[model samples]
Target: MSEFDQHFPLFSFPPSKVPRLLNPLVLAYIGDAIYDTYIRTYLVSLPHHKPNHLHHEATKYVSAKAQAHFLKLWLPHLSEEEQDMVRRGRNAKSATIPKNANVLDYRHSTAFECLIGYLYYKQQHKRLSQLLKMIIDYKENEH
Candidate 1:
């Protein structure tokens, strides 16, 4: 178990329970936190920058536009099951809409978050790392 797992036992639910117990939006909710944490932690690990600069840099990666772009580029690489989860998330209706993103981008972002949530809940850390690395690589290639 990771250090956080030891500290927050309540968050460590069995992977098998995920499908039966949680809806897509709930998964995306958890996913939003996990994805944001991953982005912020990665930014902090790089060369030092002002807090505002760091936040600005993170926005380029964390926004709905970016996430939707990332998903589109990576879709062909995903397995059938992963694609299915993405489809489920994209189809889920949400009461709230993001101020900065269009409906299509928002749906894609939700799908991306659902995939992350599935990986995280299943404790597939290695797969999660691979996918995150792909995102980082995409960022690097963009510039």
Candidate 2:
């Protein structure tokens, strides 16, 4: 078990049970929260504690455009099965689109969130951490 599991001790269903049971959008729903929490924690660790600055900086990472950009960059690194999960999410028809995000970016962002949710529920903690680290590294390098 990794340090995260030791500290957090979240209960995860078996991988075999997850994709078969949950809708892609449902996965994206939880994934959004999970990613948001990770981003918030990361920002706070960097000492961006002021509320307004924290929220503004978070939008740099958590916005749909940003997520979609990261997803595109990471796609070539994903496994075939992982890619399929993204495909399912990208094709999912949501009831509404955010006024700020374009359709393509929103779909791709959903795909990214779906992958994160899948990895989380499947308890692929190490892999999830690796992917999350890649995002951090990529963003940091963009300076």
Best by lDDT: 2
Candidate 1 structure quality by residue, lDDT tens digits, 14-113 = 5556552567787788878888888887788789778998999999988999999989977988989889889988998999999999999999999999
- Regions of model 1 farther than 4 Å from truth: 1-16
Among all candidates shown, the one with the greatest TM-score: 2
Please write out the lDDT profile of model 2 over residues 1-143, one tens digit for every residue: 77445433465444445453789998898789878988887888895589999999999999999999999988989999789989999999999999999999999999999998888887788888778888999989999
lDDT of 2 at 38: 84
Question: Which ranges of candidate 2 are over 4 A from the true structure?
Answer: 1-17
Q: What C-alpha lDDT does candidate 2 achieve relative to the native structure? A: 0.86
